[model samples]
Target: MARRGGDDRTLDLLAWQPPEPQRYAEERVRTATLRDRISRAVSETLKDCEQTRADVARAMGEWLGEDVSENMLNAYASQGREEHTIPYLRLLALVQVTGDTRLLQLGAELFDTTVIENRLKPFIEIGMRFDRRNRAVAIAQEEDREIDVAIRTIRKGARQ
Candidate 1:
């Protein structure tokens, strides 16, 4: 039998063959591209609809009993729920008219940070007392320390 070299030429030639480029299947690429476009379109449509809804809500609030600017009204109306419930809409309007981002942010933060709930407890109590059904007494009560603190903070920041 003929002796063969440890590194065989024939084996090296076979191993040297170039690998074929991986081809993405046409159907998968097309489907993914189409899905992405549809998702983008839906997002844009929702944004536009939200802006329009906010404009309408702000207009309605102005017609009610507040000298609410469009910007403030829009901000309040933008917070509305899709369910279109009257009470929820009213709450958004109240929040906007009051320009109380502190309360809004505090409410959201309370759910995330337990310590914030403690800081917010007094304010929440005052707010509950003042809700639509009990506005008269809520308003008549002595000045709210917690609310005063919040308003002062807002004013201080605005001046800066």
Candidate 2:
């Protein structure tokens, strides 16, 4: 038998409905929204140290020498707020106040990127090899997990 390949029309015809695809699409959009992700990251970072909005606001005000109220900070973390993006300086302050990089990491992960400190841009290429090494280590970790899972399954089957 020979198979013929067609374009968009064929794909459209062959696509499966699989019940409520629209619902899945809507949910994906809801969850993947950048604003929502940032807000969630802020909330998670706060939760780690058992801090409240007021605590953050007070700490930030003291650290930055500005008056930031609890309501303003709460609005930033809450959904559908105008301040979807936190200022870079404020974000730095958040890192200092919270003592956690989760918020910055979350924003970077959401965009499939990373934040690395660089003192001199001209000398920054020297760090590429180190970054590649880190990537290799990550791949090795994933391989180790796969091997562990395989061994566990094999032992379970032998017992059965």
> What are the Cα lDDT values of the candidates?
0.44, 0.66
Q: At residue 138, give the lDDT of candidate 2.
A: 100
Instruction: After superposing candidate 1 on the true structure, give the runs of residues whose Cα lies further than 4 Å from its correct spot.
Output: 1-54, 60-64, 73-91, 94-106, 113-160
Report per-prediction Cα RMSD to one decimal: 29.4, 20.7
Reference-based TM-score of each model:
0.18, 0.48
Q: Highest TM-score: which candidate?
A: 2
lDDT of 1: 0.44
TM-score, structure 2 vs. true = 0.48
Which candidate number would show the highest lDDT if scored against the true structure? 2
Candidate 2: residue pairs that collide: none
What is candidate 2's lDDT per residue for 1-160, written digit by digit as tens? 2235754344453443333111112232245577776666555555565677689879988999988777776666666775655666777778888877656655565577755544344345756877889999999999999999999999999999
Q: Which residue runs does candidate 2 get wrong by more than 4 Å?
A: 1-30, 110-112, 115-160
Q: How many pairs of residues collide in each model?
A: 0, 0
